[model samples]
Target chain A: MMVSNDDAALVVERIGPQALVEDSGRFGVRHLGVTQGGALDWVSLGWANWLLGNAPGTAGVEIAIGGFALKAEASMTLAIAGGDLGATLDGAPLPPNGAFAIERGQTLAFAQPVAGLRAYLALPGGVVAAPFMGSVATVAREQLGGLDGRGSALAGGDRLLAAGTCAAPREMPMAPALPREDVALELVTGAQIGHFEGASLFATFNSPWQVDTRADRMGVRLTGPELRCQLGGMISEGIPLGAVQVPPDGQPIILLNDRQTIGGYPRLGALSPLACAALAQCAPGTTLTLSPITPHQARRRYLATLAQWR
Target chain B: MSDAQIRVSEAPVIRLETVGMDALMVRLFDAIDEAHMPWILAADRALREGFGEDLVDLVPSYTTLLVNYDVERLDQREASACIRDALIGLRPASTAAGREHRIPVWYDESVGPELPRIAERLGVSCEEIIRRHSERDYCAFALGFTPGYAFMGMIEEALATPRLKTPRQKVAAGSVGIAERQTAIYSMRSPGGWNLLGRTAVKLFDRERDDISLFRPGDRIRFEPITRDVFIEQGGDTTPLEERG
Candidate 1:
């Protein structure tokens, strides 16, 4: 692939509910109250980049729930990974988890979700957007990152550029299986976990929790047993990604990439990184369960997953 | 580092807790206090310098500093050991190290929609409320909610008010508001429930600026009352706030 200074690789013909450019995340500046904005299903993002022979943290477009369409301005090979959003290339069904070449004037459109909630589209190089605070991840709430560097979502008639040229598309041998059954999210319990009543702890692990409609990039609310914590009026502290905070109402909200930097609610624990990625693909009303795992086990699992990249 | 060099007369009791797979929380105290700033700042500095390329981010809040690290580069045991090594006998930074800022604000019923309501609730004049709010200096306890939004606090007990039951859909940039003892300026337009007292012309956050944010955690802030004309002269928005129909 080669680049021309004034040429756009693709043009946004139509955008559905939401589409944002995301990279690894913004970092080293949370003290300034900046949220780490990035792809929710980062594992998929890594695979998307890997298929295109780009670095794991390269920026890509995160298409949520479908209805997004793009026109190729130039002939190029692009990779699609993650959730099985009903995708079509030039009016034909386009399978995911592989790289495909599109000719100029061909239309690439996503109809609806066939399996998961989001799909990752990787440009030959990466989605080229002006970086804000060392990241191109769009955090709309904070008005940071995106095409204009103002956190604007991908809209109609937007021109997208590639950061650089790619070598050649590589064949993807194996992809992780999509979770179809009741998803089990592994939680690394700590931080106010002891304050929860014994029965609540049992229910937290034993019960089936449904994904509530009020879920987004900020956090996901789980409808389950009313978890009561004995602690009263805790001082607000820094919140990490995947922190499952139990508010006064007892419902747990798992904080995600764009969550507030600090919060006061009691926390049962945080979901492991892989668990968070798996949960990100879950649609509303998806049944899930929590399983407690030691920090050591969580780290070991994460390392094993990372080993797949090489 | 030698133990004698880092030892302090009264070191804060600390806890290093793992947060998920890639982060650790360094909890300094169970409660919030202005005195905790010195220690928090010290640990933040030590951790950043210690972790170097491995540190992802360090979020320093009221009572804890969250250290998000590169999981592939450093394991939990190695990260915990590094944190302990950097903080084992760490001395708290000087309280005087923080910068002091005097922010000018225009207090009135127009921009501050809740001013009249709060005055009536306390059975005091709007002028009296302004005076009470500006009489003392507040400490910047933490920065959250949005970029450059400093949560400052310990307002006069009499002036401490609860948040609104229903949050406003759009809180104008530079809107200064209070919820309980904490007061903050809305760095950008955001949905909020804080009882607004006034607005400021000072830019809380500016990406064009070298520092980006005007206030850092542990800084001191004092509000100074300004006339409407002064507020306008300083580039403050004077459009009266209105309820969404």
Candidate 2:
């Protein structure tokens, strides 16, 4: 459905770096070579939607590294969660992790990050955009999804709309912990994990790895130990989200939502979904340690986390 | 052989590997094989129906299928059971499974910068390289790297070329290229490392189409050589792509 200007809630004044519309993600289409594009920090996105009482996977604006400003087109209520990107209402600081009321012509601006790398802003209903392949999540590289239905990032002059009017506002007492200097990520060991040398395996979990600047929605390159794999190049196979692929150079890249469908490099294992959410919040140069967990343990933890939402 | 006899033959042993908490890597074969396509497609179809609402996404590649499931609905054990049951008594689909496509290509030095280099490396003329590449009907093994980008493969060994040492910063849409034994069309312009040989006007991926992607996993594909004029007439871009520093 087309969102007419009558219901337009906000208008983009400026965009710094990048911002995009995201939801749970695009699925059931991997065979078409389409990557699952969505909010990198999914936990926060859920909380943002929760604050507004929308479905957990409802669409929201993922503002990355701040410097985005929007002018309220109409009086409305919205929720902000995830990173503390120093959001403000007409120059007054608006705290993250709760719903707030804004008047017409009031400005909601996001400055440089004060905590995490990305913040999710959810509307009362949800950001209304034409869903491409069943999602409005933008994968810029693939040119799919977003306001224009071509994966374009939020830019000046773009109009934003919410599907429905607001209900009673809600708030969360706390938000997910912001990334720290030494964040420990939970990883589930599998797929070619035994092929790595004992020493490399030990280093993978025991040492500190720094997030490299080559980070994006696709994947994050962790620099630290030169992990050596005993196995040679194998046939290119399907890669799952969070698969830690170690290339010939030894730097391990943790593939994420927007990663390619297949890869040939050897992999140590994959990070748990929660771990991926945490890692997405870490700024480049943040130190990280890998904590091994079993698939059963990971599943239990995933269920427990989801249970908290309801 | 009869259908019953084919089913009686030893089925390839498949293994399942845990991918994080919610997904499993269903490994069909340890190596790449042309025969693996039918089995992969069959498994993909079965799992899509079997998992129903529980399945999040299933990614099929050359030798493995990564099944992403909803952990809220099924645990690891239950998901595995569903997978095994769906794959029970699995048989490869017949040779004639998916749609066949005839893609017309315009092969020229102006559009394919790597054409002369590839011919020189193979010690053959450009026309010979094009002839060898167009002669075989390739199987669409997978779709990836980008939307509508189908990785069709096993080009003539004589025509096979290694990927560029350094990927071109920009590869125009419809640029046909080969990397090792694999050949694919650049469905959308992006940075690519493949060796370009020609260009196609066909839109492999069109959002307006009922099926956004032109090629499915098991589709058969053949390349028909076309004149530059025909390529231009068919809406193919002939503007030379320069190698950016």
Candidate 3:
């Protein structure tokens, strides 16, 4: 059940739902105007690495929706975290948020999620992949960051190889998975918050919004009451991640990791990082509410969350 | 960072807000203007210099600079304070004017697909439309939509045209088009709705070239017209400019 030092390849047995090699994200190249293409749910990506005693930003696999299956060519220790997409190894159900050992020639498979949309798979060390703009996060649209450094998603017959040596098998206590359904995302109103009509503002915070089918790494479209703004014909400006932009159609689109650098649409505000993580796992038709909070409160909550993970 | 040399100006329009746990947006004045561009550039340069590696990235737009940092190492208050101080010390003298590039374009019917429609809308002959468009110098206002895509501003008032009602699913690379007050060259083949008037044989974006993008914000551009045969002879397949430098 051991892989020889010269044997570096891990063969694929089955390709379930969706699996793509990912890392912290591409950075330092935005000055060249490249988007920071990375995992849609970075918090979960970090947690998955932490579970395996690897650097939080190490490259791993991001399995969306979950029906991915893989066979190990060599014995290895792996950790699965983020999203409770039912995962199993060789017909035995495996729990999320902990590390396990897989022997050579064994198969690992994931089924449709019972909760959450993205799941992370981390090897003992990290996934071996070439860096594109200083990251291995796969961004298919930009044609950057992937296993081959071409930003292609995982297709059938794709092979994954782990980098570095495997650590001794260890058992780490698992944390309770958060409630993904009926989650309330927190918002910190932007400078343009005052421009929105009072009624629209009220509806924004009070009304329930449904995630529209038009969702991607770039942004998520929300179907809810039209948000009217007082300002018309405003100049286009640099939009931030999580900025809830209200275009001419009045529907709100929350920009995400792969959003364009700038936008002209008026924005109600930006959702906090934690809120974005929660929203990232939500499927189309899932309802969400926006709760406004002060910047101070948002910062405190974000710091607290990070501290817990650390 | 020392405060002695820092000069401060009140940017009433620029709003400072937390974007995420780790990012903040230092928005310039609400609207885009020639005066604001210098300030935005200076502030961005100053902050990068002041923070060094602490700053994750600085994204500059026509009127805003989004600064991303590491939350584990820096917080909103510390980052905001540093940025505000840097903004106050920002001097217009430090902002370097972006390089100017001249692009040759063929404005004839074969190259300029929308020439006739633009001429009819402006009540001018097709020749006059091309003459006016080629004569006026354009400033690169920003770059976005796709890699190497430069958004130039203040097209000739007469030649100013609206975008097409239905955007073309695939615009050829090096296609020069106009939309309202902005003129742009499509760096790569992609969907676009602008009014196409010409194509350039010169590569606007070549990944392999040391200068991947021919134009940057603040660069001046002029279009030169040439015949169709010469364009094909130049080995222009509109393939993406490979990264060389």
Candidate 4:
């Protein structure tokens, strides 16, 4: 099977709670006080693009808790990955992490999530849009970079286009190892790690943290143990992705891609990127535990994961 | 870049610590002051000159410069060591240049949601409150909490107030506010607790503008008090500013 240059177009029939155009991430502009707006699950975006023989960092659509439907305006090969969003093409099942062609009248619909919270849809030449700040990653809060270059979620009647062209279909040599059933997130102990009292530390590691309903692309609020950090009022500081910050209320907020550029809260540390990807896939009420990994260990794991893309 | 006065031995020793696996923070002070800006700016320059591509992004806030790096090229230990050494060699900011933007603000009882209450609490008149607030020329220290939301300040000590007892459910974008030493514009309609001073006619952030960010670090801001008529004359969309063109 191969992709075609038949002006492949996707028309949004029904949009989910959220659907966005995303690349790997917007880099080198964090100093401009811009947040890195990209795929919450970078791993899945890579795999979707890879299935279409596109570069790993190419743009794709990120559908959250799918209730989305798209009608193909022109026949083209596309790929999907991430959480099983219970997708079906013309009522037939479309499995994840595989590429297939769709006819002009075919309708691809995704119901509620089966396992994962997000699904990525990728095309041969990737979705084409003018770049803002050198990226097309949709940041709803920032209102920058989307199909319209205005950062709005996929709306009904919107037409999606790719640099549609023919390319040889490629299959994954082997699928990456899926995350374990018991979700154990890994965080590297850093800034203000010593500031937390031993009791809080004990609770942090031992207790199961529940993902609060207040979770979003900005960050996930973990509610369970009130972690006390022994520090005076903090001056605002740069916040990295997955930084586990404890505010005055003692609840921890694990910041993500759409998080603000800086914050003034004491932090326990930042979670590994892989752990963040896992956390992104989690729905509200999901209980997970934080496992401390050395920075060295995190580097090895992150690089090893990136190695699979090429 | 060359015209800086940084000395290795005389400068205060900067602490290099970890914010996360991918980021190394070079902290200069616990809190921020005008004195710290030069040091922070200098350190930022030194790091950019020193590490180059290994440095992914450097986010400078009031007290710390958070450096995100490629873990493959520079691990945590090396990044910290490199930052620690670079801090010693950081050059002092030499006549750092920044733009001066005079924003038009309508300071009226009706214009400011919390002005009357803040005036009563401070035992001052609403006019007096506006006078002290618009008098000082505050610098943009950092942007965070939200996109295009600039944390610019060093407000007059007498006018400084703590965050609202309970933050407002929503603060309109372009609303000017003060909380403690910091004064800022609520660029987006986000929940904020700052004492609302007034609203500005000019949107602080507009994606349609040539420069997406109106306020940058080191930039000076002065509020030009305008009449209500002038505020309306300029597209007075008092609703929250959406991040759009």
Candidate 5:
């Protein structure tokens, strides 16, 4: 079904620092050196879609650090999840986790992060954008995916068009708990895990690390104890999402979806997807601790969490 | 060696580890070498083919292939078992057919700012530098750092040099650089520390093309020295890439 001009959905009124169209993620193309661009907090993205009766992996907008405003071009059903970006619908406070309707001319504004760093806005059937590299997820550095197809963040004057009729409001089957202060980010050790000194490993698990402002979609830098590794010079190896690499500086930078396909720094391990999502919601200076978990335990917990969506 | 010996020899050293919920890191070698390239490429293709939809993404580096799969479908034990079985079906690298390319590069002081410096450091003339650099075929061991940027390697040792002390914030796409027995064309304009020797007229990455990336793992590349006028005529689009002659 085609979305006519009468129900054009959202119109960009004011823009924020960073906003991009994202989905489950871009896959099967990392071999081309193309980084997989996806929602940093995939849990919330899934919830936002669930609220609107859209597929869990449907494409949606990820509003980062707030300051985004959208005027409803047409009456439509939309949902917001992740972060308490201080959302207000036509001056009325709109909470996250449930679907809501906006009449024509109604403006929905996201002011600032009240709870989480990013909030996903899901419209019925998702906004219109052709999948690039098997995904509509956006990565600016690679200049791929998203609305403009140039891998750019949302700008003013952009129109969000969604297909499908407005239905009754829906909610997530089981919403993951919101992030709290000094949350522990669980990690499963990788190849270079044994190469690190036992002292550093002990400190890595015990120490409280501060999130450096240098964090981005590529990776998050933790400024705390210096993690020492015995491996002198390591060859650049394939890095996966949430790979916790400790550079020579001893600071561990957790690689994300937009991270370089490969790196040479010694790695401690990779964070579980849920732990990564919880860590992604954290703003700069947020205190975080790394907890080591067996790969089997991480996998079981992940499967358990994923069961909620299906 | 006989087939049994090859299988027995290859089986003991290959190590596999569960990277995350969605990936398995298969270690092929303890160090970097041209010999390991075949193993990396063979494993990459074999596992990718074997797993099919189960594999999300498989990245082949110098000595490892990080096989990313959907943990929802296959658990750690099952995925590792599939990988080990896939490794058993691998053939010798001599049978693999890698793509070939003759990339044209404008190697001169005017285009390559570090060319003269590189020549002086090696105590060789600029012409000799270009001749030695372009004469050999380089194998693309891996693709990383950025999209479509193939990490081609093992350049002739004579021209190899260390990377810049401070990497330039912006190195234009197509800028060919040689550092520590490796020469790679900057597939896109990004910050890099490789010693720039020349610039290529061809864009190795073109999204508009049916096959987005020009070079893949095991692809053979030979650099051809071209004049500035010829480089200009080639344009920035897909018209520049020439068939290897």
Candidate 6:
């Protein structure tokens, strides 16, 4: 799908908070030392795209904690997924995970989130944004991946245009709607899992940890009892998404999409791909538990999930 | 060579595992080292050439290759086999030797502020320290920590210094610095703590340029001293190395 200049929808004005555009992320350039900056909740972004009949990798808006408002200058079809942030269009309440036909000159707004930390807004074809290193994901820190390809965050007076015109609104059945409560994140034992003291390992699995306020696209610091490990003075090593690292402070910080490519800390384990998605939707102070699964099981489950998406 | 022979040869450095529904990571090695560079580069090229359209992107870090693909189009078994077959056909390229670039730097007080402290720790004159630093050629081990940031290797043993006890809030772009045995050039202004020796005017990273990065992994680099006048003429600011890129 492609969006032309004449067919583009303009953003006349924003009412509450601004929205930053994102895609899967700029990949393959990490060797050039670029960070993978992309949607915080990849699953939600994919769902938004699936609902709009766009490819899962298509670009969309990632609104953090809601309050984003926009006025459409042209008729368009859009989809919202991830956390329910009380989204409304032209003063009419809109639901998440479904497509809607937004008329030209109508205003779309979101209030403070009642649940979930981020909401994804997807256009029919996708958002038309400049690509940097082959991705339009906005990473404000590196100033890469955005409309200008300098990774600028959305602000007032910025107009968001859709890449392609909307077709008839597609309906996603509720049978597949993701469960919003009591998610169990799967963990795959990592290289340093053996380093943690035996009791600490048991405690890590047994105890409930709260997502601390210190959270962002980079990582989420989990608040829980101090977990001791035997390893020390680790040579800085490459970090993967969902790796549960324990720094000197002993609290676990699960790395995410916008995380640095490398780190030097003892890691307990990594969460399975689905678990990371589940964790992405979780808000601060949300309680979570760690459960280990074999790599075979993890791969099987992950492949099964992808099959459904296809 | 037969499949058995390839399997027995240099057991895959990275362990393959599922990252998410659509992502899989090939953990090159547990730690970073020069020995792993050839393997990593070979694996990256092999995947790209062999998988062709089946692969979304192959992300190579210090010791891991995150292979992303269109999950809707390919399954784990098929993808895993394709990756394995590509690895069997992999051969380290001669181009992997990489290119070399000589950067001109001004190591005087105008560009360098921590030079004196570094010289004192090494029990040498500041000028001597600069001479030793500029005399040797260095190998680019990896491009990481930041965009276009080349992490070179094996500085003079005497010149090796630990990162600052507390990192500076911001390090200037084009700042040439050393920490432990690794030396690096800061591509953009960001927080860092490497011992600053001097600065260069060349843009290490420019999104507008075809070659966005000035240096890459496995390149050779040397520092050539330049006058303050030449530095400014080249578009370098007069601030300390930490404040100018």
lDDT of 3 by residue, A1-310 (tens): 2233435456665566567888877676565556776777777777777777677778888888887888887887888887888898887889876788888888888888888888888876677777855788887766677777767888767777777665553454457455566779998887678888999999999999999999988899999999898777666556666889898788899998888767788788788877887888998999989999766677788787666556
For each candidate in turn, the interface RMSD (Å) is: 1.2, 1.2, 2.4, 1.5, 1.1, 3.8
Query: TM per model?
Result: 0.95, 0.96, 0.89, 0.91, 0.94, 0.87
Lowest lDDT 10-mer window, candidate 5 chain B? Answer: B1-10
All models, DockQ values?
0.72, 0.77, 0.41, 0.63, 0.66, 0.34
Can you write out model 4's per-residue Cα lDDT over A124-199, one digit (the tens) per residue? 7788777888899998777788988878888999888877563676776676444435679999998689999999
**Any runs in candidate 1 off by more than 4 Å, and if so which?**
A1-4, B1-10
Selected candidate, larger lDDT, 1 vs 4: 1
Output the lDDT of residue B41, model 6. Answer: 68
lDDT of 1 by residue, A1-310 (tens): 4454446479999998899999989988898999998999999998989888888778999999999999988888888998988999999998878888888899999998898889999986788777888999999998899888998999999988876766688877796677776899999998679899999999999999999999999999999899999987788888888999998899999999999999898898899988989988999999999999988899899888777777
For every candidate structure, what is the RMSD over all alpha carbons to the true structure, in angstroms?
A: 3.6, 2.6, 5.4, 4.1, 4.3, 5.0
Put the candidates in lDDT order, highest first.
1, 2, 5, 4, 6, 3
Cα lDDT of model 2 by residue, B1-245, tens digit: 12221221235788988877888989887766666777888888889889999999888888888899988899989999999999998887865666788999999887788888888987889998888889877888888888888888778777767788899989999999999889999999999999888899999899889878999887878899999999999999999988731
Docking class of 2: medium
| Segments of candidate 4 deviating more than 4 angstroms | A1-6, A177-180, B1-10, B232-245
Tens-digit lDDT track for model 4 on B51-126? 7889888888887788998887988878877777766656666535546789889886554666777789889898
What does fnat come to for each candidate? 0.83, 0.87, 0.43, 0.72, 0.73, 0.39
* Local accuracy of candidate 2 as per-residue lDDT tens digits, A1-310: 4244555569999997889999989988888888888889989999888888888889999999999999998989989998888999999999877899989999999999898899999987898898988899999899888989988999998988988766687768665687867899999998689999999999999999999999999999999989999988878777777899999999999999899987789888799989999998899999999999998998898787777778
Docking class of 4: medium
Better of 1 and 6 by TM-score: 1
Q: What TM value does the first chain of each candidate achieve?
A: 0.97, 0.97, 0.92, 0.95, 0.96, 0.94
Better of 3 and 5 by lDDT: 5
Weakest lDDT window of 10 consecutive positions for candidate 1 chain A: A1-10
Candidate ordering by DockQ (highest first)? 2, 1, 5, 4, 3, 6
| Model number 5 iRMSD | 1.1
Residue A139 error, candidate 3, Å? 2.0
